[model samples]
Target: MNHEKLITLPCQYPEEAKNSFKKLIFEEAYLLFIVLGTGETVNKILDLATKAAGSNQDPGMVIWITDYTVVSDIIESLNDPLNKLNDLDNTYAFALSIIDKVVDVIKKDENKLDILRIWKSFQLALKG
Candidate 1:
């Protein structure tokens, strides 16, 4: 994997990040979709992230941040008077939505101490 290249993919905006992700997926056809398309389960996604991080994809960095963090970072980086994410890609929007749902589930789980704990458990389960 090309760590430098993937690490350089801008996460400041949704459009750029999505385009970069799409580019990487296209270039490394066997990196993500290869595993995801199969019935590899959640580990496939985590494995892809690790593989991409080892390469130039920086999937770990992308997945590490929470939905609120991503939104805050994007908003804070903006200079326009109206801080809107209208230019973000559909993939980013979809990701945020999924994270939102995960957040909701964690909220109702009652067993988890916090989001970080939930995330850790989720990762461990995937690894297992």
Candidate 2:
């Protein structure tokens, strides 16, 4: 893998991201998975995944993992009327930036990303 640019991964290119994720299981002898989260719970989860994979780390694949739950948690916490980040306009705009990124990613592989949402957070309930 000579294309060593700074990959802020869970890559925008769906095909490449899917390929990179699968390629190592057979090709590389060992795999280490890291799940970055806040504090101890995350620590435990990371320990479970990495330790489960065990020992040989760094096959150079960096995957970015996250969800809307973080943002939704912030909104729920700041439901107070006087909170600075509670401003409707700014919050909506911030949300739209995330939407824009999703739009760009979907343009790459709509079906695959939709399938990703099926396992991740598609929120079909949001429609009704």
Candidate 3:
């Protein structure tokens, strides 16, 4: 595929084209065809992740306050409340913060795409 032509393939609508390509390829692979595809789900997640990332240029500067401050300013507010959930390890806190960003904590990549394809197939098979 020529680079110029390939780039223009989605000049105006990249995501719509990508999802269409995923559906076509998954359902009509040369060697094997998948019964179902989760490209849409993955795309939605990716969109949310992008929005979350763009909305926070400097997330560290985000204002932190107690939800109950309105009820009682006396209560000591922990800016890093997630720290309490996983005191032993902060990985959960890190992940939780990501999840808090509009239910988007992860992005799909090539590796996850393959897994999503198989998982979608399994889900469909189970439904039947």
The numbered model that scores best in lDDT is: 1
Please list the C-alpha lDDT of all candidates, in the order they appear: 0.31, 0.27, 0.25
After aligning candidate 3 to the native by TM-score, how far in Å is the CA of 113 from where it should be?
18
TM-score between model 2 and native: 0.26
Per-residue lDDT over 1-128 for candidate 1, one digit per residue giving the tens place of the 0 to 100 score: 32232233344576665555445433432212111111233233334444433334322232322233334444333332332333332112112121211111122213434335434433432332
Q: What's the ranking of the predictions by TM-score, best on top?
A: 2, 1, 3
From the highest lDDT down, the ranking of the candidates is 1, 2, 3
User: Which ranges in model 2 have alpha carbons more than 4 Å from their true place?
Assistant: 1-11, 31-40, 47-128
Error of 3 at 79 (Å): 19
Please provide, for model 3 over 33-111, each residue's C-alpha lDDT reduced to its tens digit, 9 standing for 90 to 100.
1111124553343333233322222221111111211312111222234232222111110111221211111223334
- Model 2: per-residue Cα lDDT at residue 89: 26
Write out the backbone clash pairs for model 3: none
Off by over 4 Å in 1: 1-9, 33-128
Candidate 2, run of 10 with poorest lDDT: 95-104
